[model samples]
Target: MLFNSYTFLVLFLPLTLVVFQLLRRGNQRMAMGWLVAMSLLYYGWWNPDPSKPWTPFYLILICTSCMINFWIGRFLAAHTFTPKGRLILGLGLTANLGVLFYYKYIGLFERTMEALTLGKFSIPDVVLPLGLSFFTFQKIAFLVDAYRGKTSKYNFLDFLLFVTFFPQLIAGPIVHHNEIMPQIQRTVSPSRRSVDLSVGISLFAMGLFKKVVIADNLAMVANPLFGAVAAAGGRDLTMLEAWAAAISYSLQLYFDFSGYSDMAIGAARMFGIKLPVNFHSPYKATSIVDFWRRWHITLSRFLRDYVYFSLGGNRKGPILRYSNLLITMLLGGLWHGAGWTYILWGGMHGLFLCVNHAWFALRKKLSIPALPKPLAIFLTFVVVVAAWVPFRAGAFELAANGSAQEALRATKSILASMFGLNGFEGWPNAAASEVKFSWAMRAMSCVLIVWLMPNSQQVMRRYFPSIGLRGLLAKTSMPGPRRFWQWRPTWQWTVFTVILVMGSIYEFDKVSEFIYFQF
Candidate 1:
């Protein structure tokens, strides 16, 4: 169920909270078990139909996956990583990845091989299970940590709750076992439930406003422009249209995802659990490296620790490190979808990161002065928005059934217009004055918000136990007294939050799924 939906807001959330609060007073295990059942129900709540037959298997698949991985983690923890342990770890990795491959990549693999060999085999498109990418990574992290003997004393129930915790389960901040398990163990105490509730409500209200009011509205501007370009052949979009479309989608994605992160964190907070900060005003980042650091913070952590570090990380020299960076990003891109456009997106970022690192290396040697922070932030945002063309194209292709060539062509067309390679003579290109005014205002408004605003984490920064990656503690919260706008248990803030919720509710009839759900 979408966190934005009325059913979730009106029914599911309050009911769960009430039950959890009541059960917390009694047995803690029952409270945890209740959540597990509800989360499973939440995942299975999306109805299976003739079109997507695989939807029915989502529940069974997740449970089986949890069962298998939980035991493997236990096995890895109980043994040493010598002869048999290494072998089991390998098999464990293979088993998890194999299921991922079968559902997420097999169709793309088949189609690619068929095209290469001039074969005519028809490949059915695979609708990957919801939360598969996220939970798989979390599970893999668990297994690897277990192998290193970092994880211990985890029972199946605690492990299961960690994996299927509904708020972050579908599209995640990708919670780690270490980050969330202790919180699960302590849910029985309602000691801070009131504080958590207010914080949760504030976060949810702001996020809901972001998703329904901002992101969905921006999608109206973006979707049509991209759709026109992705038609059976393509359309010639003017420079104004192209850049506006790209930036609109980028902003849409930002609010859609970060908004989701805020709501997820908020909902979890209602249960007195603090999820790690995932999106912390990433567009505010001044470099590609910084962008990754802020955007999808957990996924970056996963790739860095598991993928890059495993490949020898920066412990290696420059050449191998750069190559490893590219490889990791390519894999990261592919993890988003089984599409060449996604791969291209990854390749572009990989190249960007390599260049970014190379520039840092040169600066260190030559003692070059850094660009002013504002300029760096602007340039970084431009590059990031340019990269989003391919990502937006690939996301559209998931529904368009468009070929890789078409996706590439569409991406190139947009990028060309964005860069002034395409014609700009007929700017706004016959759009009505009001239509143009509305569109420009909406897109530019989002741009200003991205550049100027404090994020959800910052607004709620007064709260403790909030997790931020290294160097981001200050970013997550200011050092001094609570800012006037910072969230607190106050009457004024309650009214402000109500206004935000009201604005969100006005758009409730137009509820839409979040953009990241496709991942």
Candidate 2:
């Protein structure tokens, strides 16, 4: 269920939180049992209708994969150097990855073949399971770590909890074995600080607000731009509309995905389990390499350890290391989806990173500043935003919409419509002011929210009160009150949460799935 949905916010969350907290009063094991049961229910809730609950079959497939790897982890931990251990690990990886390939990529492979062979062949349909790629990678990483003696054998329950922890389960920061397993063992109760509850709820509300009020509104502009291009049949976009569409989509993706991440992190925190922060202010990055460090950080770590290192990483010569980097990122893109576009996306990033590294090396060698840091930051933002057009668009043609060719035609049509020079005439008197006024008010409210609210990182540090950049900023800025942002934490959070909930409800009709869920 979506965190922003009424049922999740009003029904599932409150009930689960009460029951889980009550169980935690006894012991960590009891609390974990409650959590496991609740998490399963949450995962399976949509699939229980008996008509089309095939989604849970996917969950079952994942659970089975986890169980197999959990056992493999145990066995490999005990016999790391033996041939049997190598065989077990290799076979486990093959089975897991083979399943992933069959489900996720076979259709694409078949389509490519059919295109090449003039529809002479067709591939059988495979149901891609929810979060299969994520869970599969996590489990494989576990086995590899065990084989390399980086982690100990974990009990089935702990392993299961790590795999299916509902907060990061659907779309993840992709929790690691080393980062979360110990925390699961030592369950802690959330303190009944009015401040804590207020902060948690507020962060969740802020996330909902971001998704509904900001991203959804932007999608109106973004979707139409792509749609218009598609309608025109492979049209080029004008510079203004291209940049506008690109910027809108880039911001939409940030707020939408990061907003969901905040809700997940906030909900987990209400139960006193601190999830690692997933996003920094990545838009503020000055370079491509810096951007990766700040964006999808857990995935970066996973790719570095599992994919990059597995390909000999930097251990061989520099040329081999560069080859490994390119290959790893190419695979990483494919991991995002079963499409050539995703492959291109990943390849572009890999190429960008290599060039970035080379440029940095040259800068160090010559001791020259090619551009000011601020200019570099601006250019980086533009490049990243442009890259997102492909990432957000359904197809390549969609990304090329609103070009100069289209804009020229659009201008002719618009002028013809305006002057009654074509089939169009006078404006309709039926266009009501109330509808427009309501929309204007709503738009203003969203703008006010963006101006007043802090980003996800800031919200996280506020609730948990951490010591990173967020914490440091809060510490230094706490005593002052800006014109509109002046309020005590308790009142500020309570009021903000209420408004966010109300805004989400108002925009419920346009509610969309979390963007990252597709990945």
Candidate 3:
């Protein structure tokens, strides 16, 4: 069920919280068992056709990975890694990645081959289970840590809970077993501070509003623009349309994924567990490196430790290290989707990272003044927005709005339809409506977006500027002892919460499934 939905907000969450707290007073094991059961039930609550049961797929995936890793941990703890042991570790990783590849990309591979070979070859169909990418990484990390003898053999129950802890289970900050398994052993109870609950609920309510109100509405505009471009036989778009499509997509993707992360983090907090913050105002980043550091921080950590570091990391010479960085990002991109577009998306970032690193080294050698932080931020944002065009578009050619050859044909159609030059009748061209800027609200809407949205740094500077000499005097100049009222007025919070809830409700019906659900 969607975290933004009323059913989840009013029914599942309230019932589970009450039961968990009440049962916490009794057997802690029973309380946990009850929670695990509820989590499973909530996961499957929306399923109507039993023929395609989701929970079993998840259960089988989690159970197999956990059991195998638990054994691997025990084996490693008792024995050292010989050549044979290393081979076994390799096989384990392959099995994990193999499952991911088959389900996620085998179809795309087959389709591409068929297109290349004139339909001579195709792979059999396979169903990708929900959370395949996420859970697979969780298992790979578990097994690798085990092989390195980092963790002990955990009990099956605790291990299972770590894998399927409903909050971050699907789209994750990808919680580590090291962080969460210990939390399970702790006393699970409501925090003594009412503020904790209030903060959690408030954050969750904000996320719900972001998803239901803003992101979903934005998608209505974004979806059509890209689809129209593809339908027009991949033609060069005017700069206005190109930027509109690209920026709309960038906003849609950011709010959608980050909104899901916030809800996940907030939901876990209701149970007194703090998931890592996945987004730290990524749009504020001044470089591609900075962007990765802020966005999906946990996944960045995973790739660095498991993939980049495993490939000899910076321990190798400069050339090899750069190669490792590129390879890691390329694979990282492929992890997002089954298509070649995703591969290119990953490769582009890898290329950017490589260039970014080289530029840093050159700058250090020449002792160049750092780009003005504001200018760097602007450039980084532009680069990222350009990258999103590829990520959002159907194919590489589609991203460039078709090649020059295809643009010629598209131009003919555009001219034919525009002035009735080719006797083409009925069904006006989409390009026609697009040219009439006065008829479209898209331009005004774009301006609204730029004005309303500020990066986290901007927000911080505006509301909580530094205690510099000028600022310290400003605070000291207050007539009376400053009250909390000056900073955080109760009426403001109440009004904000009311508006958040109202926005969430108004768009309640369009609580589109979390974008990360596909992963």
Candidate 4:
């Protein structure tokens, strides 16, 4: 179920919270077990056809995978550093990866084979389980950590909860076993319940506003242009239309994914569990390296520790290190989808990262001065925005069933339009004319918010900002204290939150799924 839906807000969450709180007072294990059951229900709630009964099959798949991984972890922990242990680890990795490959990549493989052999082969459809990529990566990390003797002993119940913990289960900050298990153990305590509830509600409210208000609205501006481009079979676009499409999607994706992360973090907080921060004002980053550090922070961590390190990391020479970086990103991109566009997107970022590291090394050697912060940030943002075209195109291909060549053509057309290599005229359409100025204003407004605003975490850290009449009453004359946009728990804050919640509820009738759900 969508976190934005009425079914979740009005029914599921409230009931779960009440029962969990009450059960915690009596039997802690019962409370944990109740959460596990509800989480599984939540995961399986979105079966498209009730008559077909697909969700139960998926539930069994998830449970069986969990059981197998648990045994694998135990085996790895038992055998430690023996050759037998390494073989076990390799086999376990192969098993998990084999499942991921069959479900996610087999269709792509079949298509490639058909293209090469002129339609000599066919394959049945494989239904990819939701969150398969995320949970598989998390489990692999757990198994490896167990082998390395870095993980503590975890029971099956705790392990199940860790893998299927609803909030981060679908799209994740990709929590580590060591990070989450202790928090699960502490959920029975009532000590910080009130504080958790208040903060959690506020965070959830902020995320809701971002998703329904900002991201969804931006999608309205973005989706049509891209759809038109694809329908035209990758025809060239006008300059104005191309820029509009690119900028609109760039803003749309940021708010959509970041908003989801905030909601996940906030929901977990309500239960007195803390998920790691996933986004941190990434657009403000001054370099590609810096942007990766902020954007999808956990995924970057996962690739670094698991994929890059396993490939010898920087422990090898410079050439091998760069090769490792490229290989890791290429796989990372493929992890997002089974498409060539995704591979190109990943390859572009890989190239950017290599260039960034090379530049850093050159600067150190020559004692070169750094570029101005504004220039650096602007350059980085432009490169990031440009890369989003391929990422967006790949996603469009997945939705529209367009081929890789079509995606490439569409990407080329859009890039040409963006750079004015195509005609500089605007696309003449009623929809485009009606919303052009408004869309521009909205895009600018989003840009301003990203560049100037302190993030949710910052506001949460200091609930009271000294602004308006309140600033005059402050004892200190500090400049930072006199800033605007402090998020207090006053009536003003209450009214602001109420408006956001009401607006989000009004939009909830449609109940759009999060963009990250596909990943």
| Candidate achieving the largest TM-score | 1
Question: CA shift at 341, candidate 2, in angstroms?
Answer: 0.8
Instruction: Please write out the lDDT profile of model 3 over residues 1-519, one tens digit for every residue.
Output: 777777888898999878876787777777677778876676546443558654465555556776776676566555546676677778888888888888887776666677678776646666666677887788788777777777765777777777777887778878777877776777743443244355556666667776787778677766665656556455444445555556677777777886787677667766666666676667777889989987787889899999999899889788998999899998887787665666667888999998999899999999987999888987897788767765665342323233323322433333333334545343235655433443234532643443346422222222221112133235344334544433232567668877888878988776678777766
- Tens digit of lDDT per residue, candidate 2, span 1-519? 878788887898999888876777778787887877778777766553457535557567667877888888999999787899999999989998899899877866776676678776656656666667777788888888888888965688888888888877888867778867887787443454345455566667767888888888877756554444445453344444444455666677777877887787777766666566677667777898888877777788789988899789989986887788899888988888776656766887888888887888899999977788778877887677656654554343112232223333443332233234554432213241112333333432443343345665555443442213443354456534443443236566567668778978899987688877766
* Ten contiguous residues minimizing lDDT sum, candidate 1: 426-435
Superposed model 3: Cα runs more than 4 Å off: 45-58, 80-85, 116-119, 188-195, 232-235, 394-431, 434-495
Ranking by TM-score: 1, 4, 2, 3
lDDT of 4: 0.82
> Which lDDT values do the candidates have, in the order given?
0.86, 0.68, 0.67, 0.82
Worst 10 residues of 3 by lDDT: 460-469
Across residues 1-519, which tens digit of lDDT does each residue of candidate 1 receive? 899988899999999989988887888899899999898888988764547554557798899999999998999898857677788999999999999999988877876988799887776766688888999999999999998899968889999999999999999989899989988886533547888888888888888999999999898888888877888756767777787888898999999998898899888888888899888788999999999989999999999999999999988799999999999999999998889999999999999999999999999999999999999999999999999999988965555466787788899999998888887634454542213646855685789888887777777776752566335865443555768877788889889999999999998878998877877
Question: Which structure is stronger by lDDT: 2 or 4?
Answer: 4
Q: Which candidate, 2 or 3, has the higher lDDT?
A: 2
lDDT, ranked from best to worst? 1, 4, 2, 3
- Could you give me the TM-score of model 4 versus the true structure? 0.93
Residue 365 C-alpha lDDT in model 1 = 98
Report the poorest 10 consecutive residues by lDDT, candidate 4.
Answer: 464-473
Q: Give the TM-score of candidate 3.
A: 0.82
